[model samples]
Target: MFHVGFVCAEYRRRDGDGDDELVGGSGLSRSPSRSRMIKRLESLNTVISSIWWVFGFYWIVVGGQPLLQDAPRLYWLTVVFLAFDVFFVIFCIGMAFVVFLALFCCIPILAIAYAVASTEGASEDTIRSLPKYRYRPATVLSTFNNLGMEEVLGARSGLGNNGSSGELFLHSEDSECCICLSSYVDGAELYTLPCNHHFHCSCISKWLLINATCPLCKFNILKGDTLV
Candidate 1:
């Protein structure tokens, strides 16, 4: 009776195998997950490329319309402007590509660095021992005060001449103080730095008391001075 039962079980197993094959064997039953992902990526790339092409086409069609008209001056102006726009777009795209490439290349380098740091058992003392790249706030503040003191004294000496501040002068109408974001008024007290940059006397004095460099160009005022 046991032998007969075993034979029946074997027959059932064979019947199940035939049904599995008919439904599609185990090897071919699973979905193509990787192929679906590739399709998705391809579709995304196609959509982006299509949008870029459309934008370029529209720009060319609309931008050249002025050139096709009879106004010669307008045509030349439009041409120049379009040329600059194209150049700017190309430059931005190139910069973005370079940034993307750098990021892609840095991933593996960062992973390796982290792995090495972990394996070597990095400590706080070792990190602190590494060469620092930042400047101390105290040093920056001292330099600012030192540079501002000389200008402040000069402005005071010039103040006695007919109430006109000698350290300040009226600059061009278009000139603006970068620190205060104010346009230069006629006869307003202005301070001109050694770098030929001008600013409001009050605004620059306060700024120099905190930073020794030119606010706009960042030229160091005390770079050349030394203890003789």
Candidate 2:
């Protein structure tokens, strides 16, 4: 807070083009990482303000004080001017703080709000109105309960992650649920959508609710569709 005013004051003197170029190309406005962008800007502003504030003090001490020993008339005049300069600096610092805070702090927020708000297809109502399903695949034991030892062993073999080392008893185009990026397992609950796409129960539910579309085919689930 000590040098906040000074830093803000110095900002008025800085080149707008450099910052504009950096911000314009940064893609922060189109990103969900907008919060991170703001944090970085605040940190960078503090560092820059410190540098400018320290240099200002250094210049005043090293440059201004050296000129006071010439003569009485000049000495008094210098003293009066220095006093006025100090007051002027203080006033400028206050005004500059308000201007900079208003200008710099609000730019990102407003830019990002407009950038994202202009987009479509996502809303609280869409998410809240989404359907959910709790799918349950048959248990392996039930399928193999009355089977022979060889059949039971083969069923156990297909449970391998890639089915690379096993007999691959359970194999299909839907072997893996893309929404969760995971392979289906026996008794794993899932949602089979109206588009005939299936995903882990929680995975597709969350995804569909967020975008209201099938993660695979982009089927609009909110438009008279439901979980199968």
Candidate 3:
């Protein structure tokens, strides 16, 4: 047994010495392939993160303050967005559909419709029109899922902004749930608005089945609601 162990130890030492000699001769203290791979991965991550941040910031800024004063800046930002979209499309073919969206297919159509609807006064038209777009709604999926708008806005909900999970937030305590006849508990389950009302999640889920509106205010839950 001692002889066998001795032979194995000598074999390991010989192998270690050969590795050290090869490394020293090549002057490669670490594996070249690993270093190259890490550098390539880091470069790719930087590009993707930059794309995400630039567009994300533009979306926040313009969407928050949509005014003629910033229109030119917004236009250039849109160009950057388009360029990023092109790169994204190359890498993610599924995202190529966003090109059509960038073309103003849906938003422009809605904008024109809204413009014609309230063309009586331009200032009033601008106020209404701006709000129509300034807010992006939180997406809700399944209708059966009882999660709140915060979850969707936080991007925890898998549904995209334009998808079914769209709704606005309510910031009034005057709103009451008829089922409970009480003011909402902070972080309480609430119904979405323009139909600004509150309800327990369980109560609202059951209520929606029979009637998709707030019982106290008769505000519609399934439609015309904005998520804050």
Candidate 4:
């Protein structure tokens, strides 16, 4: 009797297996687990692709223009900025990009600033929130004392009027690139800000993207104003 029961059980197992196959073949039994896994993989790929795209752009920018160059300070600063720029581009898209980009850009600006601040004679300066003023194109050329604008002039401070601001004057057509503080000969390329402050084109471009303020007086360039 026991032997017979075992044979019957075996037959039942085979029959159950066949029925399950038939049901699957007829599409009555859906493989929900496989479907879910495929969808999850696709979503993950999309996220990864977005991140890759952002970093690619960020690296191109960093490689094109390094902050410190041969200076020891440049290495760590570069790492910080690269990480920040990549993270900014990845998570921040659309209007949010502007905010993250501004923050990432500050990494370099502050790095330069801190270097200057740490120097023996340079005064300590902190960037408070910039005040908003009306945009006046005329102020771009005028001096800081003029009404069209106030503050935000020159490359370095203490070198402008009394030669005590960040502003540096160039007598040699190639004397010094105000932006990077490197010597430039004629046709080296420079950008003259509304404040009559000159800098390397790339340097000023980086500055404008971050603050739209003059490195000298904190003038709001986006407001159609200058530091001069």
Candidate 5:
């Protein structure tokens, strides 16, 4: 009978599963058995372990991660912006360096050119080179004939020994060739610049081959002449 009573009490505890409702008498709850309590604690730990993880045994503070594969949206956005900022800063620095290098290289060369132009004169200065053109009939010819006029300056001046033509021919003949300091021989071919400045065919031809500017007015011959 004593063994039977002990078996009955043990059976009641097993049925309880450490739950309050199974406790006998007056319906009051009882503290669970130590073994039951331990099992319950272990089950709770198992569920938590699946959701949260701790890593790094050697570190002072272990890092606990809630999710391994998926990060927070805000966190990844922050990382992307930080990466872009780094590239932008590097590009700005490179551009600034290029600008500084350009200025440093150009200033002295410009200063030297200015000095040469001032001291030696426009003709002697080589740095700002005048664009030289091969003499073509279009650029060096006069407006007196079709070779010169080509309909552009036909009304302004005419062919003949009268009016503007007379004065111009007379003046051109009396004046010396500015480039070579030579006299114009009668019936010799003369090339006239758009500036209406005339020179010997040989002198002006060679001059155009060397420099495209009119020797008297410094007008660029390649640019259409501003007939005076």
Candidate 6:
């Protein structure tokens, strides 16, 4: 009996020791993985910070050198670009604030407006039933008229010699319309802007209607026009 009791005690002690070792092993395994993840996060942060520093240094050198060299036009051009950037950022912030107010305070504003309109004998139903605003086709035509499209087109036509093969031969073989990515095809109608850059008639016409500039080079097509 004494021998059997001693054997049982030894078995229980061994089991307790085994359980403690298993718990310790698990903790040890998890600690290494946790430390590795932390190290990875720290490395990523360092890389991002380094990239920003390089970008800032580059811009400072590029933007500051013109001023140091006494080039007033380039300096002022950079300053104007920065000023426009500031205005653009402010405009974006203002737009976001307006959208937030519209989303949250819309019901209150609409209610107040409706109450005032109703007092002035305008019915709520009539206000709700009003048609949504849309841009007119004449707006595009008016913009073209303002840009003096006729004079610009006539000048462009006179500059480039008409190719008899229906394919416009560009001076450079590397020439490709930046818009469509395709090389000017044989039998395709093309228009050469004053900048000497050529594009398909349909592509340049659509683009010029929106903005009057060479797409490849941003030379203003209306720069020489006194009426523009």
All candidates: TM-score: 0.26, 0.28, 0.22, 0.24, 0.29, 0.26
Across 162-205, the per-residue lDDT of candidate 4 in tens digits comes to 32223332344435545577765444445555565556656666
- The whole-model lDDT of each prediction reads 0.56, 0.56, 0.49, 0.51, 0.51, 0.55
For residues 49-114, write the lDDT of model 1, one tens digit per residue: 668656765765686665456566866765576678779899999999988987888877897787
Q: What is the C-alpha lDDT profile of model 5 across 1-228, one tens digit per residue? A: 333544565566656654545553433334255446555655676666434322222121222143222555644564465567568889999999988887888787897787544332223333112222212232234535664454544433343212222113323534567889986554544556667677665677667666666788876655554323
* Quality of model 5 by C-alpha lDDT: 0.51
| Residue ranges of candidate 5 with Cα displaced over 4 Å | 1-108, 111-168, 225-228
State the number of backbone clashes in model 2: 0
Which residue segments of model 4 deviate by more than 4 Å? Answer: 1-170, 225-228
Candidates sorted by lDDT, best first: 2, 1, 6, 5, 4, 3
Question: Candidate 1, TM-score vs. the true structure?
Answer: 0.26
Candidate maximizing TM-score: 5
> Which tens-of-lDDT digit does each residue in 129-227 have in candidate 3?
211111222223422245644564445223322333323333343445577676555445343334434355455555555554446565444443332
Q: Give Cα distance to truth, residue 134, candidate 6, Å.
A: 38
**Segments of candidate 3 deviating more than 4 angstroms:** 1-175, 217-228
lDDT of candidate 6 over 1-228, digit per residue (tens): 333554565565556556768877434444455556545665676687668656755675677875647887866676676677669889999999999998779978898787554323223332222221111122344335735655544443444333221223332354556789876554456666555566666666667655565666665555532211
Worst window of 10 by summed lDDT in candidate 4 = 122-131
- Clashes per model (N, Cα, C within 3 A): 0, 0, 11, 19, 1, 0
Which scores better on TM-score, 4 or 6? 6
